[model samples]
Every structure is written in C-alpha cells, then in structure tokens.
Target: MPKITELRGLFKPFTKPLHRQWKYVWQEKGKFNEPKLTLPKALNGRQLNIIDPLHDPDPNALPDESTPWTSPTRHPMFEYLVPPLPREQHPLFHHDQPVFLFDSKTKLHAGVDQACLLTKAIPFYELPQSIKQNLDKISIPNQDDLIQSYIRQSIAYDATKEHLPRKSTPLKQHRSFRIEYGIPRSRQMSILFENILHLCESLGGRYPDLFKRHLYRNTPFYTTYERYGEPIHLRNKNSYVLTSHTPLSPIVKRLNKLEISSGEKNDEKLSTHDPDGHYLMKGNDYQFLNMYPVYPTIDLQPEELYQDGDELGWRQRKTNEYVHTTFYVSNDELIHESTTDERLARMVMFAFGSALVQARQQYPNGNLIKPVTVQSVFLLDELFHFVVFQLNTLNYNETNDNRYNYVWIDKDNYMYDNRPSMVMHNPVYGTERNLQRYVLEKLKYNPDVFQKFLALYLQGIQGKKE
Candidate 1:
C-alpha cells in the first residue's frame, strides 16, 4: 500500500458499509392474555325505586280504613303526570329475565306516548285524491318560483306610498307562499325547503288546494332581505338576518345570533398571521390590553348537575320548569339479555345530556322566562322509547334537589319495522296514526297539556313578524 491514509481515502469514496435493516419482532408470538372485561351491571343488583313517597302515594302502603285524597292546591299540570306502570304489566319483566327497566318495551311506549302528546297539535293526515293525481306536475323549482312571487308582494308593498296603491295581487295562488319568507341560501334552509317540498308533495297528493293554503297561510319563510333590512349580501356587519322558519322565539333568537356571527366573521381570518385576526390573550397579556369593562352575569354550568352513585346509577340536572323526555334503544345483547331498564336509563342520560347542552346554547344568558320542555327518544331497531320531562324550576345548580318531574307511556309497542325497501315505497304511516291515537287519548285524560302544547306549537309554526 502506498500509505494507510491514502488507502483509507480511496476506500471512503468507493466503499459502503453493509447495514442490517431492523424491525420489532417478538422473540415469542405475543398473546393477549388479559381477560376481556364485561360492562358492570347497573346498581349492582339493587332495586331501582324512582317514586317519591312524599309526593307520590303508594296505594299498597295505605291502611285498610284510610281514604284516598287529592291535593286541592295541586298544580294544573299535576294531573298529566303518568303513574308508574306495574311490574306485572311491564314488557321486560319476566321471572327469568334481568330486572332492568329503562330500555324495556314499557319505557319505550312511555316515551313515544309523551312525544306524541308533546307535539299533538301538528296535523298529519292523508292528502285528498285530487291532489295526489297531480303530484307529478309539482317540482322544487316551480315551488321556488311560487315562493319568490310571494316574496315580491312584500317588496311591492314596501315600494308603495300606501294611499295611491292598487290592491296587491293575491299571493295565495302560489303553492309555496307563506306569511313570512326568508332567503333560502344556506344548507339548513335548503334542507328545510326540501322537506317543505316533500310535505307539499305528500299533502298535494290528496288535497292540492289545502296544501297550497297551508303553505301560504301556516308556514313561515325567512328571507335574506326583508322590509326590516337590506339584502343579506349588502347588509353591514351589525345587521342580523332571520334564518329560521320556526315560530319559537327562543330558537329564532338563537338563529339570529348565528346569522349575525356568520355575517361578521365570514370574511375575518382566523389565523394569527393575518393582519386583522383576533387572538385570545391571557394573564399579563390580557391585563396590559385593559379591555372593556366586564359585567356580572349568571354563569349556568350544566356539568355541575350530573351525579353518579349506586342508588340510581346516574343522575342529571333536572328542572321542573321544563318538560324532560328520555328515550332508549337496546342493543342486540341487551335485548337478548332482557336488560331493558339499564338500556332505558342509559338512553335517558344520553337524550337528556344532549338536550341540556342544546339548552345552554339556546339560552346562553341564562334568563329563560318560559318553561323549558325536554323530549327524549330512544330507538332500538324497531322499538321506540320516549319520555317527557317538565322542569318546573330553572335552578338546576341545586344538584341535591329533586326539582323535575316526568311522565312516561311505554305499554304500547309501536313498531316501524318496515324494511328499507318498503320504507321507500310506503314510508311507515303507522307511527303518525299511532301518534294521533296517543294524542287523542291524552286529550281525554288531560286536555290542558294538549292545549298548552298546541299554543306553543302554533307559536313556533307561525313565527313572529318583524
């Protein structure tokens, strides 16, 4: 070799070291030795007793000579409370079956009964034959045209100086005409319009004139432009657009807030790199800015309402001021195992939990003046579970207090077990009929609740005018 250093330099330029590719390989095949864990049984085999002895009397506990009495000062709505179904009457109660009540057939019927009663005011009937014959002629675009014509009437009225104007053309001829109309640009509005069109089609199949009348008189549409504001596109940042067709004031107000934020924030960049982007500062950064004065407001914390214990398995913040509903759907295992009660309880938690979150969003200021109603529905394949809860107090912060009450009707097993193919053809009209019957039954037992719901339902359907 010329020199060791020279040889090394030559080898470094041409030679490559052989390296082995390594991968994680078990010396012995891995085994999943850990046992699969089963879900813990609800209440650890303890009996579930939801009855309040102080409020609800036990017929069995009465002495032989004791006479039954009713409260004179009982609230008007107290009569509407559904009495607990007997164990013998419960569908899931069998000597061999697990003692659970929630997802049982009885509970499902109770939920459905309550839901049906809650919105009993909504009309659901088969359309007349004359409308059905001409259904093929109706189209979404045509409906849009009709709605546009109705909107033009408002525009035309606004343009006139009143005294010299001729009688406005009758907008009722248009099948899509509504007392209140809004621009249909958003995905939600589009979906709503689609559903309206479907409803029109369904009703048109039977009574075209009635369908037209309902669309024009009963349904309300929110537009991007109205007499109260400019076209949504040209409106300034502070302008609020009415987006919902529902008459529920609270829901409408919430929708307005959404529209305002959407309009103002649409063009604003969210990234810190943008010149006009806003950032949340903390500690010293926030202190240095010395922002606008903050006012004191009630902070409604929904999370504080939840309690977990062995007694009832789970508890949630409930207010007697609002109606609360629970729904449950059992899985195959639960259904096979006859664990309806546990299923029902789980469903109630889910349904109520979701409603609670929505309520917080809808009433962010925490000044809900009207009673809040909660309807919970649980579906297990073909089985339907429903419950209605009324919250009498908004003070959900008091976790220890039993401030809410509920009614359930789960004895009847209303099945919507139509196959997907059959649904496309027939579309399960049985549920509507069943709901109607439930409403009729409630009307007989408690017409006041039905009337109260009707007023609220009508108010929601006929949304407030500007």
Candidate 2:
C-alpha cells in the first residue's frame, strides 16, 4: 500500500486513481469508532418473542397455559412502587379565617378614598413640582417628529396582528353595534411601550440595560396586612413591575416626611379648621367625607388560604428588591368602564405601595427601614393616569404625629383626542341596512403627552452614566 499522508478535506484530488486509496481513506475504522451495537434487553426479565424482524410477530395466538416460561422472579424491587401519603393537608375553601378581598373582581366602593384608608395612604392632587421641572428639563433628539412616528408604527403593529373592526356576529342590541371600534387596549399599550423603549435606546441608549436588570412581567405578588384588627390582602400580578437594586430617593421634603400634621392628613371640610389645630387621626377612621353609610371595608370578601409570599416579582435575591415603577395597562379584570380614572389611580397606588412595604420584609404594623417610592402609570385606551407613592410607614395604629404614606396623582393625560375615521360602505350588512359606517383612518399623536410619559420613565435614571 502507498504511504498515508495528512489530508484536509473529503474530496482531495488523487495522483493515481485506485480502489485501495478509497478504502483506506473512507472505510478504515480507527480508535474513535465503537464496537458493533447491542440490542436492549426486554422488560420484566422476559425477552420479547420476535420471530425474526421487529415487524414479524406471531400471527397465531399461543395459549398462555401452553406457552413455555424461561424464568420468573419474586424480588420486591421488580414490583411496581406505591406512592407515599402526603405530609400536609390541602383544603378547598377558606374555612378558618376570612381574608379581605382586593382582587380584580372586586367592585368599586362608594367612596374614592376607600382603598387609601385601608392601605394608610395620604393622597395629593398633583405630582410634585420638582418632578415636573425635571420632566421639562429632559432633552430628546427630534422628539416632536419621533413621537408621531412611534404612534403610527404602534397602531400599525396592533392592526396587522389583530382582526380589524368588521361585522362578525349578528347582534340584537343596538348599543353593541359599533361602527368605530377601538383596538384592544392591552395589545396596543404593549406595542406603544415597546416602540417607546426602542426610541429611548436609540436616543439615550441606557434603557435596555436598565430594563434587563429591573423590569419583570406576569409575576404574582401580594401584600398581607391588618385593618382594624382584621386580616386584609392585596395581590398584584400580570403587569409590568420595575424594581431597582436600591430604594428610590425620598421625594417628599425632609420636614414633611418627618411628620404630616393631622391638619394636612384631615379632609378638605376639616381643612377649614385652624392650621395649628391638633387633630387626632385614628387608624380605622375614614378620613374622607363618606358617601356610603357603612364602613370602607363594606365589600371586602376574605380568604382563609392566602399566599404567604411577599415577593416583589422575583425569588429572594440580593438585587432588585426596591420597586421603582408599575405600568398598569387596562386589563378587563382590574379596570372597568364604570370606575373613574381618579379612583383607579388611587387604588393602584395603595395596592402597589402595600406590595413594596411587604417586599421589604417589614412588619405590617411597624415602620419601614427606609421610604419606598413607587411611580406608576395606569393606561386605559388613551388616558394615562400617573401616580407616585412614597410609603414611609405601615403603622396605621400609631397615635403619634408620624406620617404614614404619600401618593401624588396626575389623572388628566391623553395620548390623542380621537382617531381619524373615514366613511366606508361595507357589504357585510347587506343592501337592507344603511351603508353609513366609519372606519379607522389614521393616528395623530400628541407631543406633550408622550413627553410626560417619557419623563416619568426616565425620572430616577437620568443621572446614571453610560
């Protein structure tokens, strides 16, 4: 045989063509090759009765009494294993204790501040002026033009992905026949936020890393606390909850944070009282003027079996315990048309703040280690309800001058006035029905509203370097 030489590829040209060169080069087995394969053994210590090939089986049934057995075993390990009994018991219903219900299915209470009273939050009408000034100061590249582009692009994605507003089913009700149908609010909201984040990355280029470390979605969390010696709980899930490695710097002034005068904590009707008046605010008292004759806890249904976890969207880790913001897009479960924007904003701040306080692993009736600031936005269709909550203490029973928590809300922000509509003669209704109908034409965005949203998103992260 010719001397073997080092080669690089499979199809190298040979000087003299022959069968021997082909055999050594292609078919020769070396150290890397394994021995011939062995068939797997049969189960239950009995070999499978295969006459020849896998497809060849005994066509005629052999009687079990006449069949010959090679071997049998009485070993205990060969028998099927039985499952062990459960150590803990699980119940179907909450029989022992009733937990106050604050889930999505809960209806709107008569008073706007019901959730506030339960969570021990003080409500402010507008956002802090310092935040507004900071918003105005934030700069963007060609923001006016980019805002409109983003608005159009987001709507395009929503329309292309989802079915258009066309007549599908025959409805008997007149109110149900809508010629101008708005796209699904939740879907559109996600598209818009994604586009905005992309824009922020293009301009500022730090949001991607921030979101990687902070943002999480669909993580279930709940805060358990007591109200008037009764157990209460609130769960927050299926929303975008952004957290940070460290707590947000306190927003309220040092003096105001130290103590909120009972006068400040009291309602407007009580506002007329002397500025220096000494008012004693009770833990269970309804601070606002009541529309409902009963207590704020009127409709809270309870559960004996409540989730004991106080996670802020992740497992107990060394990072991202502090919640920075929660973007609540309208889910039909949590938001309804009957509830006003103002009330919804208040409810979100209370529920989210309670979650943060619990995440800190602090006692519900005691002071928090530090202030937990949470900024939130509630987007329903086009309206944007912005809220900022600073939870200082969960000690509602404190008789001292300590301030509990603060919530700042700006409820009057809209992305656009109306979507441009065009008349279309749709044939789905047939010739009998009037041809008068309107279809979505295009989207015209607002610059100021988008700026406000961007400002809120970039609030605490502006000072960070690349």
Candidate 3:
C-alpha cells in the first residue's frame, strides 16, 4: 500500500485551487495580501468533489436545478431624469456653428523691440534671390516647384558647417518638422472656457445678432464602437468590443444632413455620447482673451561625430532625439518676455502656416466648396492683437500667391491700461446695441491700420452676403 504522504501527493492537483479560482481570489485580495485560509485537503486518498446544490442532479426537482450563478440586473437611479424626447428636437434648444477658441497669457518680459532690432527678427524675402539660384542647381519637377519656392522663401539655414576649417569638424544635420503646435498637454483646456467667454462677449458687442445666430457655446459628444469576431465564452477573456468617444462639431451634423439629402451612402452613424455638449463659456471676467498661440517647433541638439578606427575619418552616428509637440500658454506675469518686429512677423507666418495646413486637411483633393477662415488672437500681457485670414484659393502651382486676404486688429495703445475703451467694455444686460454703436464709431475715428482693415472686413462681409 502507498504511504499517506504519497497518497496526498497523488490527489494534490485536485485539492489545489484551479487557475481561474486562484485568479479571482488574487484579484479580490491583491497579490501581496492573499488570504491565510487553509486550502481543501484530499478525501480518502482520492480526488475530493463537493457538488453545488444548485447544479446537482435531483430527480424530483424541476429542470431549473442547473442554473448558474448570475449577478442581479441593475437599473440606474437617475434613469427617471432622462427626458422622453431628444434635446435637439426640443423647440427651446439652440444649435449653431462651432467656434475655435485659443487663449495665451504670456507677458511681454523685455522690450526686445527697443534693445536690438535684429536679434529677435526672423528675416524673409517675398521673392528671395536665393530661390532662383537654388532652382537653377536642382531639377525640381514642375509640380513641385511651387512648394520648393515657398520653402526657399520661408527657411534659411546657416552654412557654417560647410565652410569649417580642417581642424574643426561640423555637426551632422538633423532637421525635423512638428506635426502640430501650440498649447502644452498639461494646460490644453486650462483657460479654454475663459477665453471663449471673452471672445463671445467681444464679438457680441460688435455683432450681437450674428453672435446670437452663429456662435455655439456647446457641442454634442460622438461615440464609435469596434467589435471582434469572438465566441460568447471568450468575449470577456479579451476585449472583443471596444468603444470610444470623438469630439463633436456642428459641421459634422451639416455634412450628415447633406449626405442624407443627396442620397449618398453614409458609412458613419452620427449620435451623441452625452445628451448635451459640455458648456464651454461662462462667467464675466474677460482677462483671459490676452493670450497668444505658441508656435510649434523642434529643437535640434548639437551632433557628435565618432572616429571609428584611424583609417576612416570622423563619421556621423545616429543619436536619440527628443521632440515636444504640445506647448500651453502660461499666466505667470513675472516671466521675462521679449518681442520684436521679426518675432511678430514669424509668429504671423507660423499662424498662417498652421492654419493653411489645417485647411488643406479639411478640404483635401482641391475641394473648394467653402472658403477656409482662421482667426488668430495674440495676447501680449494686456495688449490684444486679432488677425483674421480668409483663404480663397489653395493651388500650389502658383509660385507667386495672391489668393488669401487678411485683417489685423491691434488694440495695443487704446486697451493697454485696461480702461473702458471701444473694444473693452463693462458687461451690461441690455446695452449691447449701444456698445456696438460706440465700437463702430471708435473704429471710424481710430487713425490706425486697424481702421482700414475693419473697412476691408466689412466690405468682405457685405460682398459675401451679396
């Protein structure tokens, strides 16, 4: 006969917990804090079996004796709060165009404009002579000439590496382009709502009726789901189905309606994840409007060359590179700030560049059904500079371009001290019309570049209507 210890070893596998049961216990108590309860022992030197009463076969019992354990169905307590009808179909609900809002709180630290005129400037030529020379050397296809011309005009590289002395070696070139720019990850939506409120108020003062009809304070949520072909038993083993939410825009609804009306096959089913969109703008404080869009760019580190064996000269080696895509506007007023005409020019260029890229993405394959408009607001401490650009054409074939028009409103001097001016006003319940008239008069009397821009903007608006 086998010893008692050997018999216990023979039945050890049956007495031990199954992998699934062990996992459940571990999940409940955590790996480090497992329970100290004694495990089941073998029965009579054989595998022990404890039949559950619910699953046991009883001849006299009903057919429901083998019912598995299941969690009780739960109903949300707030189910009564959900409205019977959809909010969008409600008579009181308002739906309007979505507005993109950007805010920056960077303070003008050092007056670089007063110190050195050339230090902070980014020089560019409309038709740079270097572009012609570059074109002469490189046989660029006719299709690519326009883009090459734009690049030549926009970028200038230092040739110090090419003319280095014999003893001094140059670093390897590692240029990178940023996919997206502005607003750091940590502070992306930090002041978004605050800035939206200010923008609404400012525009509302000048165009009350337009604001009421066109501006939307909220957007609906959109959700998408994906499913995998798996058996029902293995559905929970891995995530067989996944669900996610996407940002909703008013344009999406308009597109969907157009698709349905045109009898086009729509692949996407549009529905809101939330009953109502998030409230973006609230409160009366308008100080957050004085924010700027930080340009996205990559920083290149100095390249290091290694001399592998004396036979070969110094060769460039690959190195790890760090890239930053998100940069948020800061509200710290004590930071030193510098500004120059060149810096401002570069900022404008980047603003237009990014806007153009976004426009191209939206209206891909040369689709010009609707014009693209980008509004950029630059906040320099207390100063505010608003720029509006309307892209009428997006053909890259034309080397010399005249398809876009822009208006820049620089309210630096008048609104510098934060006084009650034409642009800056106290919030009044019923005095919007009076404020509009006051702003229009101020625009007429102002002997600045903004006055001419405003006139042009009004002309464009009127022309569009006609």
Among the numbered candidates, top lDDT falls to: 2
Off by over 4 Å in 1: 1-334, 397-412, 416-460, 463-466
RMSD of 1: 32.5
How high is the CA lDDT of each candidate model? Answer: 0.29, 0.57, 0.27
Give lDDT tens digits, candidate 1, residues 1-466. Answer: 4878544433333344422111111223335565554435775576544334435567665555666554565465775554544666664344442211111222222332232222121111222122233344433445444443332322222232322111122343333212322221122223323343343344334333222222221111111111111111110111111111221222111111112222334434432343212211110122111112521111111111111211111222342122222223232322334445544433343333333333444476755444343444444433444433322333433445322322232322333222121111123423222332333333222122222222221222221223
What lDDT does candidate 2 reach at residue 316? 61
Ranking of all candidate structures by their lDDT, best first? 2, 1, 3
| Cα misplacement distance, residue 75 of candidate 2 (Å) | 32
* 189-259 per-residue lDDT for model 3 (tens digits): 23322332233234334443323222212211111111111100000010011111111111111221212
Off by over 4 Å in 3: 1-336, 367-371, 395-411, 418-466
TM-score of each: 0.24, 0.64, 0.26
Which whole-number lDDT from 0 to 100 does residue 285 have in model 2? 33
Candidate 2 per-residue lDDT over residues 1-466, each given as its tens digit: 5335535432347653666656656664333454553456644466555343434457653347666543255356744443322323444345566677676556545434766666667666677655777677766878777666666555542444443344333243333335544444466667777676566555445444355445778777676667667777776664777666555666653423233334445554433452211122322232654535666667677566666645566776755366667776666423333467435634554445444655356445454556667788776656677887777665666567456566677876777665422222234533211211111243445677777777776666634446
Using TM-score as the yardstick, the better of models 1 and 2 is 2
**What lDDT score is found at residue 71 in candidate 1?**
57
Q: Between candidates 1 and 3, which one is better according to TM-score?
A: 3
- Model 3 TM: 0.26
